[model samples]
Target: MDRLSQEKPLKILVVTQYFWPENMRINNMVEGFVAKGHEVTVLTGQPNYPEGKIYADYRRDPAQFSNYHGAQIVRVPIFARGQRSLTLALNYLSFFASASTIGSYKLRGQSFDSIFVFGVSPIMVAIPGIVLGRLKKAPAFIWILDLWPESLRAVGVIKSPRLLGWAGKVVSWIYNRADYLLLQSRSFDESVKQYCTRAISEDRLVYFPSWAEDDFSGAAPVASDLLQRDDSVFTVLFAGNIGDAQDFPAIMEAVKAVKADLPVRWVIVGDGRASQWLARHVAEHRLDNVLLLGRHPLEKMPALFAVADALLVSLKTNEVFEKTIPGKVQAYLASSKPIIAMIDGEAAKVVANSGAGMVCGSGDALGLANIVRSMGALPATERERMGLLGRRYYFEHFSKAILFDRLEVLFRKATLRRSDK
Candidate 1:
């Protein structure tokens, strides 16, 4: 018998809070899973992500999104986030409730070989993962994308100790029940142990880092008004959500200090809860070099990266954040652009080890300004070398092909194989 035919293709149900049209890592992972000979189905919510409103195309026709890269997509009803606290809170709650009940009813007749949870923020996703797994008699594996309670505290979403204690219990509940937890960062190991009330086996936690989307690697530079060819000034681009964890206030302080003295342009793509504050500060300070281009489609980012001189990634100063590696770090390395990071710990370590570019202490305005000055002063050849080193790092360590294979192994390793179909 052929090796490929020795084992059957595992039927996987991927439960996530975000999916295609949302520009998340899960979308790429699902596509890679389909290509690797797995029968995959995605369980997700409406496609309102960074902007918090359903995409116009998705709104117009739901049928168009039913299948992606040979994997079927099943959507549950959830209110759009609308980019507000009240709505975002509702958005989180609605998905949890709907996905657990309605999602189960929808898939009642079907059986899956494995249940994989694309665990991002809001650990409530794990509850449904466990629920559906029990109903289907299949083992559920959660890919830890964000640490809750700590993430909530880091963003000032919830500050009370007692409430945070309650949240901790919620996290402990999910960690205790999951068959295995996939870790996106090695540093997350300690955090998982602290949260779980039960003693989890060492084998339960697996290192599964984010991978670069294949869409970006082949896209050529597209001429647009957003990315103008200019050599007189160094352009630094920052893409992704403009949320609280990004520490934009500190970046603004740094920009104010350096804009007068350095020939550097700061271009930020995408917006979030912090958009208004960023706009106000931009206008108030008259930081002419800084440009805030609001959110754009994912397809446009490759072109934006292509014309940029360097990429800047920032995270706030917090112990939880220090342990976290923002997904953008992988994309920046893949862009082959020298990186300027205002972060510490894991993300900073990656940038430094990759020889990407300069690093500044988190929330250090003075340090950020100095790093910008140093990067602006570098010779073109030196910058090119840095870009190449970062690209090499991405290909060697963060390629999708390598990660998809690891995912496949875990799927097969799951021993509680459900007999139902």
Candidate 2:
């Protein structure tokens, strides 16, 4: 008799260490859920990213950080990931310890239709979501952004085989605990399934990818003084996290080779763990062409992309990295800018397939330098065409609206599998 009886909105609880006020795609995902008439709650740590201190504004007025896109924000005590390995480890542990016990206590009586976990670098964050799902009798959907033990090895964070094996066990436990594991790259299917080594059915592993935000498309071309524009020089923009996973050493090597012979300039806009290292490397080597503009707001990225001749996306050379697609690739495509990818595997395949830009093996400094020269040599018309093709590919495969509908279907399907245990 009532519409509520016929159809009802979902109540989603999101678990992650990062959220709004901290620039991550999880915020967009939350916004999508809330925009679709779903009630959402985010359980996350206090905002402190790129820069390892809690946001001054957040500390001054906590209330302002509580609500975003109509979703409630639940904060937990977490150690700031100060630019050090020990601090980073403590930060991860604190979030896990706090969220698993105190975070659960904070949401004591709350119920949810689904638990969405932002499965970022450290896989331990998913534990709290799994716990919540079990306690609340809700299906837990984990968005696996990075592979755990493998990622750790790739980043040179954990090298011991025994330790990696133990980390793998944790990943296996997480895989077995969750109702659904949504993968960002389809290439991750084999690794995810084989690594789990359990009877993780095909339906349990869904290929759900990151998409370009609306901000990326048709952004106003506001000019910035950061650009080193000239008629002869090729302006290549590299953005997002400047971390170990990005292979900055290889980039510095590439810059050395290109600067001596070619008219190329690399404008980097972002900050992360490796920023200081990168800055030092740039200074020590006199890589004058390498411009480090530190960090900028998300609102400024579109403008940066709008003005750049081309975009650059790269990752460290590792087997684990090959099975992933960096979120920036999608944004570069959506921004209609020709991309130059210094990455291997799936992300490289995406750039090559989309006719967006050139691709080369990861950590190949000479190869990267060559591509920069070649791209710079290409006619303006050719570059524009590449951008167009990339944008077309974005609409074809990674449309956000389409993916949102797919999520709805996944949520419904997950509910069906809730009793799989």
Q: Which candidate number maximizes TM-score?
A: 1
**What tens digits encode model 2's per-residue C-alpha lDDT throughout 1-421?**
2322324688889999998899888898899889988899999999998689999999999999999989999999999999788999999999988999999999999999889999997999999999999899999999999988878888888899999999999999999888899999998887788667678788889999999877886545567555535666788999998999899899888888888787787899998878899988888888888889988888778877877898999998889889989999999999999999999999999999999999889999999999999988899999999999999999899999889888877786666556455
Native-referenced Cα lDDT, model 1: 0.87
lDDT of 1 by residue, 268-308 (tens): 99987789999999999888888889988777888888878
For all candidates, the clash counts are 0, 0
RMSD in Å for all candidates: 2.5, 2.6
lDDT of candidates 1 onward, in order: 0.87, 0.89
Worst 10 residues of 2 by lDDT: 1-10
lDDT accuracy of residue 74 in candidate 1: 92
Q: List the residue pairs that clash in candidate 2.
A: none
